[model samples]
Target: AQSVAQPEDQVNVAEGNPLTVKCTYSVSGNPYLFWYVQYPNRGLQFLLKYITGDNLVKGSYGFEAEFNKSQTSFHLKKPSALVSDSALYFCAVGGFKTIFGAGTRLFVKA
Candidate 1:
């Protein structure tokens, strides 16, 4: 069985601080991990992905993720937080079917 888990329901950070949204996955074979952001009442937007090659993969809006084969984790990271960056994030793993995380809400405080 393949699945994705977003350990945190919400993440809070100061406007200028770095932010991370944790994600872990379980799958049978080589996994394709992806990060998507969703604004309020909007569809999910592709942020970044880790299909193959390179442990660290960069994505939109200064976002990046490191695929850890040992840990089976693909954690999303941002160097600095922004108020406009506040949104809901989802972690998905591709297998026979795509499994999406519960979705984490990010809050950037000024």
Candidate 2:
């Protein structure tokens, strides 16, 4: 079965500091990894994706993720956090069907 797990329920970081949200996955075949962000009551906005290219993939809002096949992980990172960046982030995996993690709420304190 294909699945994704976000180990953190919430990640709190002060504005201007680097931040990271952990993600791990399980799949039967080749996997497509994606990161999305959502604000209150809003649909997820595509951040980035890793199909089959370089290990490090960059996306919108200065966010980037590294795909590790051996570890089955794709952790999202940013150099500096912003209060506006505070929102719910989701890591997803697509194979036969798409699956999303429970999601991690990021609170960037000002």
TM-scores, each model vs. reference:
0.97, 0.96
**How close to the true structure is residue 74 of candidate 2, measured as C-alpha lDDT?**
98
The alpha-carbon lDDT assigned to residue 47 of candidate 2 equals 97
Q: Give lDDT: candidate 1, residue 39.
A: 100
Sum up the clashes in candidate 2. Answer: 0
Worst 10 contiguous positions by lDDT, candidate 2: 93-102
lDDT of 1: 0.95
Clash-forming residue pairs, model 1: none
Give the Cα lDDT of each candidate.
0.95, 0.95
The runs of at least 3 residues in candidate 2 whose Cα sits more than 4 Å from the true structure, single-residue gaps closed, are none
Clashes in model 2: which pairs?
Answer: none
- Per-residue lDDT for 44-77 in model 2, tens only? 9999999998999999999999999999999999
